[model samples]
Target: MNYRLLWAGAISGLALHLAGLGWDVYRHSRDVTLAQREDVLSLANPSHLMIVAGTAIMAACLLGIAVTWMNERRFGGEGAFGGLLRGAGLPAVGIAAAGSIWLASRADSSGHVHDASHSHGPQQAIVLDLPLARAVGNETAARFVASSGGHTHASAGSFGADAAMGEGSAHHHHAEVPVTAEQLEAAAAFVARLRTAIAPYEDIRRAMADGYLQITQDLPGIAAHFIRLDYRNDGREMDPERPEVLLYTKRLDGTWRLVGAMFLAEGVTEEPPSYFGPLDAWHYHENLCFVGSGVRTVASREQCPGAFTARTPWQLHVWTVPTAGGVFAHDMPEIDPGAFPGAVLPAAQELRAQAR
Candidate 1:
């Protein structure tokens, strides 16, 4: 048996193991969400496979070395007890192999748990006329209070339910009384002022020049969001002239059209103001994971990378363009690429129906 060959194989396997470990670390740091979502710790991961292969090769090489040494000792007139002691290497290898298999099984089981915990279900929207404080049952409110570490709010019960149900659901209470004609007139007047203020942003270049940077790509049924970070935290709540974000959609001809404006409250803890009286229903996002140039809702805090689980500030959308959800809808409707500039887009419900 050539001991030199075994030593060389052992060193090569160690090198591969080290390289794989380093690669795994780098991937986790740079792409944490993707790595976790893809379960990079599993055997299917290239780095994990390399590590396993390297360990197997190194173990085989060591076993071969041990066997060769035992053979040499046995043929050289070694005592039976000495030969038996040397043969312990075989059992040692077997034990190590069993331990490795056990660890691998544990890892696979954990991967299954991770996948189950991160699974997302379809979102359901529930509308209520009563405030969240009164809408939820006493038991639900108690549970919410316990989960929130004794924090209490009129809307906390509803928010807790929303968190459990996952994202894409808006829970807001309409005023008990119907919106009066005067309130509608005032809202229309506010909308007129807002439209005039953002009229210059019809050209997307002007919006970009005015510190509105695009935050999201074009969503299939939703317009892209462009935000001015400074305006978001300026302590201005529902300033028509200084909206926190602008909504835009790309036309079929490649031109960008202004669609709507989003008004954000100054803080997450602050109660959402009814700018348009009962017509405006503000909503916030919780457990949203934000990676570079992307944001998504996760089922659990563990799924959110970088510990970005802070609830978003309450926000309301006011569409200047025609939409089925009206001017002050929580969500924007689907825009038609081939439609004229002032054309009304299909309602969000209509789009969902068409998709189904």
Candidate 2:
């Protein structure tokens, strides 16, 4: 019996399983929540392990063939049957060993599943404390939106007030025109146009590569591959802060066609869904920045607008990313949840086309 094949099969399986195990241990020691764990599992596709099992079984069979190949010439001998049994034994053992290792890899914190995290891609993320995020909640988000809209580090007086009232203060008021039914109708129309634009595109992958790319060509300096997109909307909310439910890519269509209006904000936040997903899951609050009378810099985050222009209302944005890069929740923040719940869709669709 060639033990080399037996050990080789076992070792390969063990290494992969251990890498997964490490990530799992990290999540549990840190208390990754139920919601976070669920999303991670989706990437794992525990069911996908069944595929792994098939490959492992085949590998074991192949080893048996290798060993049996050595014994094929002994076919006429009485020991041939013994040789066959011995040849098949190592691989079978290897397969069983691999299965056990893989099973022990993903351990549900509650002690249900065998693993904790799933494989999405390379992730080097730092998860900020959720409590800190809650501490900054709507106030931070609202300010971020305003700053991105060109309300920079100016005093409350600069925007018209005399006192330096904190952001979104009771005294800080906006002459926000009432959302007229006509404006709402127009928003609805935009959503309808978007649905039509995307529906013919088959799926999210193609749409992100082509459709979104074509529409945003008017905007400059975007790498189709360097970005990813996702969208969500949970209908009207009395407060608009509390989450109602989650969105699904499988059942996404016409229903998302009912957007009202989109608001641009300043800070890049640490929200989910839009703020995260795969490798390119970073959300930047995109607001129109003004340089005197000129407006530019529609795309590309790190790049500044221009040298000759004054970037006053510089579309300030705060980016939110997962603690572990691709490790973000499904119910993450939608780009423009209130307006139409479809802000990220268009951009993502453009990239999806490029991929195709």
Candidate 3:
């Protein structure tokens, strides 16, 4: 055997294996859905194939070296240490190869089943509560009728005074206009369908199991957002059954409550869907910087160090819980920490009194 040729092949194979592994890691980091779609040992995955080829070449070269050492020993070699070392190399390589194959098989089978089960299929609808659905529908309709004619009402200064405010002191509100009876009926039907479809997700664990990943920490006024990347990018428009994001609130009792569902448009350029008529006022985030798991709005791209800035898809929230801002309100009033349900936290009552 040519030992020099064997050594060269081993080095090259190891380099190739490392390169494939690194590339796979980078790809996964960029797109998380790849883990759900790609099998660990699939021949169709170029990276997996490269890894297998590299391992095979390295194993073959090591085996050749072992054979050459043994042949030399049989002839005239006399070093005990060298003989023992060469003898151990054969089984070490064999064990490593076996381990790799076993691990890959185990991972492929388990991951494929788990991912396939949760990642696809149509959502099942649940029984709807008629009274609750009607109340939500009526509330939405009332808000629109009250705000018709494009009039802006001043926000009560006393509300949310104690809570930490965002960039602007002035509250921004969208004007709600009246809709046709047909539009109102459609909006009600949409709400009923949404309530039933999202009933299963009331339990946070079930939501997580269905691929809803939490993207933000709990806020005092607003709920945390748990986004499902697969649904967000699947090219479907305004699917109430498969919302792009779920809103959750952590109660004082250490339980998570499902507050609402958020829908997303395909892109900022795309017109927002009118699934709920004029009640659904779609909005988008701009100048937002994301790093690791955290995201925040930045003045400009230059302010985001070690992070990337991008405008998010057009989004609209549909609140299940009662909020001061109504069903389609952009912001929710801060809830009392001690309150059981959705009681609004007391704002600066002194400010209200002074205003009066």
* TM-score of each candidate structure, all chains considered together: 0.44, 0.24, 0.47
Regions more than 4 Å wrong, model 2 = 1-54, 66-92, 104-356
Task: Give the per-residue lDDT digits (tens) of candidate 2, residues 1-356.
Answer: 55566666656665555555565566445432222223223334433343354446546656665666656655435576766666666667776877665655554322122111111211222222333333223222211121111211221122212334466754644423223344333323433343343343344345335422221211111101111112222232211221121122211222222111121223233332221112122222233233321234433433535332122211112222211101121112221111111222343453556579
Model 3 / residue 355 / CA error / Å: 49
Candidate 2, after superposition: displacement of residue 244 in Å? Answer: 16
Clashes of each: 0, 42, 0
lDDT of 3 by residue, 1-356 (tens): 79999999998888888888888888677644345445457655667767877887888887888778776765334577666666676778777886887578456422211110001111111112344446464443323212211112123122211334357675553332345566655656676677888999887778887888766544434466788999977888788789999887653333467878888888666455566455555655667666544455677778887455466666776777655445554444433221323212211222245469
Best by TM-score: 3
Measured on C-alpha atoms, candidate 1 has an lDDT of 0.56
- Among the numbered candidates, top lDDT falls to 3
lDDT of candidate 2 at residue 315, scale 0 to 100: 15
Output candidate 1 Cα RMSD: 16.2
Using alpha carbons, what is the TM-score of model 2?
0.24
- Residue-level lDDT tens digits of model 1 in 93-170: 768895875576455221211111121122222233223313222222211111111111222113223233325985
Q: Which lDDT values do the candidates have, in the order given?
A: 0.56, 0.31, 0.58
